[model samples]
Target: MVTKIRKSQRIHARIVVMDSDKEAVHQLMRLLGKEGYKVEAIEQINKMLEKIKNEQIDVLILAVEAWDNRGYELIPTIKKMNRFLPIIVTSADDSIETATRVREQGIFFYAIKPLDIKEIKLALKNALSKKFVSSGEALFIQKEEIQKAFDDEILDLADASKILKLSKPTVSKLVRNGELPASRIGNKWYLIRNQLLEWLRVTAAGNQRNYGTLILETMDEGVAVVDRRLKIVSCNSAYLQALDVPRDQIIGEYCYRVSHRSVVPCDESSCPVRQAFRTKRPVKFMHINYDSEGNEHYCDVIALPMKEKDGKVAHVVEIIRDNTETYNLNRHLNWIRSFFAHECRKTLGPIVMNISALVDENLSASISIERRDKMLLSSLCSLKFLHDMIRNYIISCKYETEKLQCNKKSVYVYKNIFPQIIEEFHPILSKKGMDIETEIKGERPIWCDPDFIKIAFSNLINNAVKYGTAKTKIVCWLKMTDDEFEFNILNEGVGIPHDKLYDIFNRFTRFGKLAISGTGLGLHVVKLIVEMHNGTLKAQSGYLIDNKPITYDEFYANENLYKMKDKNLRKFARFILKIPSGEDTQKMEV
Candidate 1:
């Protein structure tokens, strides 16, 4: 019953063949033997189970004619014994009914009896390709103990405790207390390692199964597990819904087949699955997966290898976290900061020249006093506004990367960050003839980057001024929740049409009152800083039902419903910049 495959060390496999026809069975043996395959054939139903347990097998080829309904009966038991084993069933009947019945039973293959050598070889090759098992056999096996019990009862408390290094008394106590299963052997108790190990495996598998189930059941993260061959094995409901995958069509398909919409695997540069397999390590990247309907989603992906007992990789587990909002915002912020920085640099020289000319003209009396003073004042105001804008842009960029450069101090958020932004923007607000105020409903610093928060709020206030009417008041409200701090800036002007609320945050979307010249990146930058602190940003424009809009709905109908109102305002673009926190920002600079 012991058959060990050799010669083709590259092809490591064990095969078991059982046939009732003596002459046909010998023919199979001759063919397999000539091909240098180690194969065992058994005719008796009783002997099949024993041979399967004793010998290692990559495949089991059973002749359905061997024992009439007996072959059908053995299939379930064999599967239970080892679910990974591939079973190929053959029948001499060649009837469609028999083939159909065996197919329903989940046999790996169904072939007519007196099987063609070609068919058998093909089935065997296909089965062997997917076979995987633990390695490193131990020499100190307890044969006597293994022989005394059935497959399920083979591993007993005595053997398991011995292998696990627990005292027999403790093992016995565990068994007696129903913590472990034990069988009575006359007047003594016995533990078989096979049974005990299998039990341990089942329990361990159960724990992992439940853990995955819980995550998929409740977690917002979408997850999927793909095998080493790049085949998708399982996915959670969230993954299916997020990917918009047709469950029946995807279950047996390869990962790339579904995700990339490719006929073959993606090329080396784009294949995260291949990298994970090649390096035997986890790989993470950001990707946008689109379904058949062409709906795109932003996903943060992590692929981890699942190793076998020998430490060889068996599969890869992929966890995808959606980050569309964060990514778009960061992208928009970078563009905004870069563009504004360029503009400020360009305007500085001109403003300085204008001021010098005005001073010289006044001193020389070459220009009228009124004209000189007006020129000087306008130039100064332009210089001041541009300088402030540049500073805010720089600070916003720093905060986005968690590298805000300033003295760090502990102070209540309302007392420090909020006041700084309000004070800095007060002159600009006055110049614009806009009234702005801050109301703090919280009293703690809440452990945050103050300079970052200040600049972020400054951008918000500036946006409100630039977009609102000249005589309107901008209300800045700060509220601290159980685990987060929220800030809201409200302005009265031509409100952002509901559709454009989400669109305005997009890098190129500058839609508001006509007078405000903007890069359409200010709100995008604000969103980036807010998210960098693990907070969220949202906007609503409309009067409150109670003349005080506390919730988004109270201000206007849910903006999201009006898809065409302003498509890009409220839904800001996102960018992902991997940077250290304020505490670790020094590492990047140094």
Candidate 2:
């Protein structure tokens, strides 16, 4: 379908010349005619397009300075007419800027005008070789009197995908499911094309116990072979079974058509196949794919380039590995850590704020004894709540470091942990008039560590109470699944930002405001305890509350905690604590 004819293939090849100077064109045409090239002269840029469309042009030779823009507009116009056609730009001016721009556009070759015949022939050879054989001239083509060329390794499923231009899932399923004949080395799967085509010819004859059939019966992945231009030369049974895509739909299509699901020609810098061809280096990428039902899959893709006889590339091999489960587990773990950190920090800020206010106001001098006693009791409760928070954090850290242990003792988990946290937060919640609700979904007497779970629940509930807005209800509940238990605390308040969700679990990471007096350890301790118990914990900020959704980003963004304030002793203490967590954590002796 390509328009440009190869110079060797033509009886007397036509050369298209675009130059403003008549003397130069006349002289060039005379020299070219003597060298057996028919000259077709065109002066205007607009006429050059017509000449390419109308006449048979083997090569386009243009004067760089004469076209004003060096045929930048004409290059694409001519290329659009014939993509494979070779264009040679000759410059009387050898400026680096012009050369760099020409090279950047992927020109066939660049040289000074009043050109040497030897250099032009070599450039023409290179361009024609690429135009015929593609990128690296590595296409495994054998002509009469010429020997066939190939790489040492067997062709792989990756190679098949490239040749067939199909998705990896479709290909891998066939290869790994034993519907094709392919061998594996470590993680790489390969196929032999010569053996496969013979098998196909046999299979078409309806006698199936041949060597190729036996190999296809054993293969665990899909396999196909492609030329440098990514045309399907052959395929096997395994490839068909895995892809779930009919061979008639994919054979002879470009590689990216199936893999990338794109119809446009690839931009060199952005195309993975082109990158491999340009550098002759293998590349592996982990990519995510989503199905129509919204299920996600993680795929590991590896692509390697094959070279032709002229040291140009002719083919590419691609392999795909599915690792969906592993990706999900890691993503879940990260989200859990982030949620806890965010919720814990939000609760921590208010405690610090109340403490600062308490210290500043002299309650004894102005308030009566009854009110004073009430206020003092409230402050003491806040301190105890803070203490319990710190304890939860320390326990979480111990569990992470593998230092937490269970005694396997029977204990009343709710009666012990609930009362302590509730008593500690009673005065504070009472002052704010915040209603606290707790419910045990299904209590079971199973083997468990009471104190660790108590601390974890305490952190979650306390966070709910502290950040829960005035007149809002904070509900705490727990449920038991088949093999695991779930604890949830819902509070009507501002949620955490989506961007900050991942970083909340790291030690010493305070999300917003220094108003809360916390050790930044609650969630870390919860994570540790969950790990120790072989359980998991997760925190969510933007859940529906009483049939209404709250936007947290704008809420937290406008908070006073985000603003700079006058320095205090608390800030100094935080500054001092920052050093050990930064450099000392890595220096912790074995």
Candidate 3:
């Protein structure tokens, strides 16, 4: 049964309802009025403070959803106006976050939406009774005694445990350990509420500091806190690990001494920490640092300033990330670019000079027909070499940047592509006294990008001719299976070393004669093209024994082949390429 307030007591009590929902406000007003309380309803939040200030309000029912939930923000303000006013909060939101926030604001009671009339009546009756008791106590106790009671408000074990959200045993342990401010009186422990609150505040702040420290310790990047004097105040484990120093040796040491191994500070213009302090803002830059053992590192440093209440920079937090590997890679790429440019100029210079000499009337008249023909041939060879170099370099770059795409079509290798490529290399082949012998067993047309296949064959054939011994035969073999096509090229020469066989396929890698002028990107480009078509390329180099080819691995395994003299054994280099044929090619294209 809902207990109603007595007629005499309800005559003086004033209850105000603040909500945007007119229907809920009307219901609350009618219910409370029937209970003999003088109830007033106000929709506007702005008028709430005015209503309270002008009249004596014993209870306030505030809807948190009113005025876009600004009612929660007004709790502290309302309390400041009348500290003793009983505020009952109502909300449609029943989430724990909302309930916790409302309860923390010192509301008398919290009710979910569609407020229960019986519950509100009971809460109002209890609030008024408590207010009357408080009024009576105020009159009985002297003001000085009330102040004294608040200062020394005694609490038993249950009260302390409840307030601290801890079990009784834990609270007892705390009291026994002297961690909590308490006193033993007549076999029971008593605590002061004021002292306990102070202890909680201090403990909460310490936990926050510990949380921040834990976060820093878990990071992969090195983090350090430095004071205004550039002395390291504290650092995480990563910072110590990066510097390869003990924590005791790092703390309180100068940041410059620990990071740069310098007696003085680093240059202010380049130091991100110094810049952050000067600007009172965050700064980031790259830095070169040395560890304890003097190993150099390229570091990316970010510094954020810690400011004081007066807006003055107090300290700077430095975050260091190692970027040495990336820096070295970029430097190496830059060097390769420079080398390519030099090679282009060197090749082009000769071609221009030769053409100019032939064009001059005086030079042409002095030159014999035989010499003129030789000069033309030399110019054409140089032009071809330059053309091949530029084409391979461009293709390599396209593949590297992921812009190269193959246009596939059926191609007869021996009939259309191989013959043309062989004819193109005739000049160089005849000059070197080398001959190419082909044994093609495949009659089926291979599904591939004809242009790319042509380039791949040209590169292989060129390498074979360039490195082969004079009067040696370069063997080319092609065979087709049910699902794949295989091509192999074998050349007799001063073969590539076993260790460098795989390395020769890398960009700008050359293992052959240094006197021969050729771009190293040809083999790399061929490897890229082959891989793009879902194919594989491999190289083997060793000596031929009994007309049968023996790889370096096999030769090393056989003691007899290993002991053979250079004059007795014929060295050879071979490359094998395997590519998917016909319908198998469509899967990779997709």
Candidate 4:
């Protein structure tokens, strides 16, 4: 028989929220609980499906993404088990492909990122209106897969045998052995379907069911239920224990006082509780909370809205998970990054310049020499490499700290940073039997820090000289758009391996087996400095043919679709950087 719910009072069923996202699971659990439902939220996909198979479920909310197909693959299983069960798919990936894939599974709805309360409610209401399959109809859909509320409604021995797939004697034997729930009525065996479901779940769990206070006390995440007045109505053991406060002291206190020790609200900028109240939906945020001793810790907070029938928010369920260990590790990493950055600038810059000058003087000698000249040139190269490595370390540090401050001054890229870098690296390229070709379109003044700009350009050019094939021409091209300045350094080298291209900008990530000596921080530093100037950068690998490759004009023509127009060419590497002119920097407050 089909069961339908027309009101919250009639929703005497369980909602299974199966999602891998922790915040999504909590939010959906709160929403379902608000509608007077017994919500069972499980994070692991396998465990969730196991519950779905064992327990009686009315609605299944799949709110998982950022993982893989393990969550989505369960869609077909839900359909095959019970054709009447509703699956509501939610994901942050709102692409057309994603929507089409969800539609193929015949889901009730596809909710995009940042779900709306109204949309969820409307979908649930629609889901409840549909009637379930009759027992005769459901029996055709694999009896082993049918575990629902109706399975325990009521059935005589004749229909009960169909659900159990056992003969009357065997069924009676089980009932006689107390393995099943049944009673004799007028010389015939009869049983409640709900009892059969309870037996199955208990037998599968190998213990008593967990619910109500038992479930609340065992949760690892701190949960607090607060009313509209910001007073805590109730809290679980985890909350009291996490705060190290007694239940009597916490029950009637204001949430703000206990969590932040303040009379006012938490950070007004992006508090999850405030956002949830304002939007009338679930909201998540990371907050820094302190203990009684003033030690700070990071908490991932999710505020779930629980609304009354009249559409008023009666209470909010807040889940707070501690992430202090992750926060401290990040703080230490930042300190290391900053220390290396400062060391490089203060000590190594002069050493490289001194060695270069001495090497030049010796190479310009009037008399014949071989061993002494080779020794001086090699030492100069080594010092240059050390200087570059240190400089890159510092740049990467600035980027992570978000301390790469912009000291904007009007300057021409072609005249100031560009020519100076070309002159500095020209000798190295010449020594490699290579030459740099430049194409600078009508230069314009840009607002930027000249020193960082020079450093970024020098890194790109020096990378070409160090890594490019000897005797191949290097291309340095610049173009000015209305809002941003674009630059590209094209080198004909063996090219970054296709497998390693994605990680070249990552700090300390060296590409696959290139003989080049580097700190592996050069590209990462360039990326950060460009971002500081409100710019962007990318590396595309392709090949040049017959001493000719895409020119500045050709790249501009297909700038919209320039990456891989063809696959038959030799592999070459191109680093592109774009800096916005006079763009504002968005700095978030601590």
lDDT of each: 0.63, 0.57, 0.79, 0.69
Tell me each candidate's RMSD, in Å, in order. 21.0, 21.4, 21.7, 20.5
Worst ten in a row by lDDT for model 1: 571-580
Candidate 3: the clashing residue pairs are none
lDDT score of model 2?
Answer: 0.57
Top candidate (TM-score): 3
| lDDT at residue 556 of model 3 (Cα atoms) | 84
Give TM-scores for every candidate, taking all chains together and pairing residue i with residue i. 0.38, 0.33, 0.50, 0.43
Tens-digit lDDT string for candidate 3 (387-468) = 8887887798777667999998876677889899889987777777889999988576778999999999999988888778
Deviating ranges (above 4 Å) for candidate 1? 1-342, 363-381, 384-408, 413-420, 440-446, 478-486, 503-509, 512-515, 543-590
lDDT of 2 by residue, 1-590 (tens): 33343444332455687776678788877776665556788876545554555435667887766565456445644554455567888777678977777766656778887778778766655654543443332222233212121312235566676755667677788777655555443355556555445545655676533553455446565544455675554445565565565564456666556544445645666555566767888866775544335566676656667666797777665555567777756754664576457654555565565556556667345656676556566656656665675565556545545686775444334565567777757776777788768787545333356776676666666655555567777776655333345666667755444564555555555556637555556666656656656665555454342344433343246455334223220110000000001222223332
lDDT of 1 by residue, 1-590 (tens): 21232346223456778776778878887897777677777766545655556545668888876665457656755654455567998788878877777788778888886688888877776676554322422212234534443454333445577666788788888666444545443345554456467557766665775575566558566667788678876677677786674454455579877765666776766667777888888988777776577766677778888787898877777787777768767776786677667766666666777677766745547877777656665566566557655565565556656785445444466775666666666656656677866677745345456666666666677767766768667776777544456676777665666677667666446764575555565777766666656666766665433235423343245654444344332221111111123333322221
Compared with the true structure, what per-residue lDDT tens digits does model 4 show for residues 243-301? 88766456568888887666578765577777777789999898888888888878888
**Which candidate number has the best lDDT?**
3
Error of 2 at 61 (Å): 39
Error of 2 at 552 (Å): 10
- Model 2 RMSD, rounded to 1 decimal: 21.4
